[model samples]
Target: MNTYLHSVSLDREKCTGCTTCLRHCPTEAIRVKDGCAVINPDRCIDCGECIRVCPQKAKHVVCSKFSDMEKFKWRIALPAPTLYGQFEELDDIDYCLQGLLDMGFDEVYEVSQAAEIVSEYTRLLLKTEGIKKPVISSACPVIARLIALRFPYLKDNLLPLLPPMEIAAKKAVERALKEHPELKREDIGVCFISPCPAKASYVKNGFGDYKSNVDLVVSISDIYFQLINSMKREITPVPFSRSGVIGISWATSGGEATAIFNDKYLAADGIENVIKMLDQIENGMIPQLEFIELNACTGGCVGGVMTVENPFIAKARLQTLRRYLPVSQNFLDENERYVPTDCFFGEVPHYKPISRLSNNIGESMRMMADIQRLREELPGTDCGSCGAPTCRAFAEDVVKGQASLDACIIKTARSKCEGCKNNNEG
Candidate 1:
């Protein structure tokens, strides 16, 4: 029961077996079984790709409700930088921070502040000797999980640093404890105002050996009306925003990469484009760069399905907001040269390469051969009619006995059904 805690859910009643989600799913996690889309627990990285492509709106996030924050004594809000761009004509970031306080949060902490810290630490890591070149940003939880599932070889290239959300949660916890010594660790609740459902899934199923410090991940779309209403009440908001251009810039694609202040880096957004870039990296087809930053969403967090505004509009708003701010507001002390010992987690322990057909090399090779042979028999058109995304994927399903060869509508329609071979030959 604890193995899979996916945030994306499919409403079978709404699903018409259109196969839209099956094709859009980056991990091929969706499969139409019995006229309803079913998500495979192992392959799903909770990137919200299916949610974006589902025509019937059958796919939705199973995020934390606003009332869930009442579980603890202190409720702290950790607003991602993407939240700042949701408003139009927003001259100040404090308006949003104060609104969170009015919405029942005991304290408000900017995830962007932590992002600045991450950027600083990342800069230090880049100069460190023996560290892998082309250090892939681990900021996106979806990218990290995708690497573990499909691109395990690139695991070494992953930057060994806690993302802004995690860092913000950790810092907020420390602040809460310092202010109130009577409160226990579990007594404090950290609610992250997120633009992505993948953040919620990350909280549920932690990456590698380190667990997320965030208690709840509530989407911006879920609490949009309430927050806007709260913002309207405050004419003069208190100054609480500690983030600057470098921090807020993390909202869009190439933002984090630019913060590195390094020229040798590649940045791409959208799951499909990200997958393509990762493939190029795996095959060593790209130029030798120092860092690779990828976002599963088109325009990074702003392009998240849960966002209120269009990604381009949000990005433009963020740019305008950053103009009034400094380059950075958070920085390590002059005495500090290296990131503290606590910044990085232990090595990944859970990644076992779930994409492999079998544990044994011989059996895996045999399965691959069978899958290739089945691919030859089936139509090459990737119509997604067989409940699988592509013909190759359908072939894999048939070889694994999870699907029938007769499931291919084209093959069966053309009198090429392998199941009826004996009858046809006789």
Candidate 2:
């Protein structure tokens, strides 16, 4: 589908032509040219790695602003579990919810409710199907896209369930109508307090049979900070029931495993650790762990690049939150399980996403030929020093007319030696 073009963007003003982001990019999507960094949309997985590493703040997530919600008659705030960890003294969930209402929302829903529902649902999946050993969590859209890109073989292993946020969004719409029959479907707008840009994109672009359930996405760092300052003046904490310590903890890695499995599981946060585990699983070295929970962010949702506070601070805040809430029963009532299955999961994708070179056999062959020609002229050093993510990417850069093949140390060395030999012959 060549959907990557919609995945990333670069601000020329913020980029200093430094190769720092290129070196860290996992997909080899970024390249420096004419003192600016440009992203190849087809290559980007929309992982937000560059968003986290950019020094000039040149990189920004394309998401809806708070004012975008003004059109809806009834506004709903769908906060991510990470939202629980954002504030230092969010004694009650109601304060945050009320703050949203004060800002303009009519109602607020906890994304963790859906997280709980899916957690319990997944536990049943583990016991029933016996289909596959390591069922990947579909909560992180970036991780899901990465699997589609780098690990297509594991696609079948993803539990046949929508992400928690989607589940919550559906439940919110249903509950909203039930509580307020006067509210029209069009009248209500749902805005997710997003922890990353990927979620915003997920809602904008349907993924794996999913439609746009969320109407808007407000970055957590943006909304919560404003609420915190708002809280100082009011001094009145809005009281609401808690979703329990485990649900609050779900903001961190392995929180889901704790909510479901008591022990004998692996919770991997951070891309590096998750990649190692995926590699082990692919190589048939998957340990005896019952399940693996992977979050691409460093410290689960709280560590998302879009966050303002450091993840460590968020983790500490989340732990203290546990002191106030009771350990409620993990299972949801049967009525709560009545999800709008139609809205959650639909038709499966027929074609798996393939690499550009592999998309067309004839084109691939020509690209291979061109790559070979560039390789002969390319510097063989493989130093990501040229700001193209890799040596092969540098070759592709040359082929694309964005880079010179002589930029490679090895290629330059060989060119110099050839010149010396010619001089000797003369």
* Best prediction by TM-score: 1
Q: Give me the runs in candidate 2 sitting further than 4 Å from their true place.
A: 4-8, 232-238, 334-340, 347-356, 360-380, 396-404, 407-410
Residue-pair clashes per candidate, as listed?
Answer: 0, 3
Q: Rate the local accuracy (lDDT) of all candidates.
A: 0.90, 0.75
Instruction: Give the per-residue lDDT digits (tens) of candidate 2, residues 326-398.
Output: 7643476777654345534553333344344656778778887898887666656667666677777777777
Model 1 regions more than 4 Å off: 416-426
Q: Which one wins on lDDT?
A: 1
Candidate 2, position 90, lDDT:
69
**Each candidate's TM vs. the true structure?**
0.96, 0.89
lDDT of 1 by residue, 1-426 (tens): 227588999888999998888888888888898899999988988899888888899999999988899888999999999999999888899999998898899999899999999999999999999998889999898898889889999999999998999999999999999999999989999999999988998898776778889999999998888988889644888787999999999999998999999999989999999999999999999998999999999989999988899999999999999999999999888988689888896765365566799989999999999999989988899888889999999999999999998889999887745557867788
lDDT of 2 at 148: 75
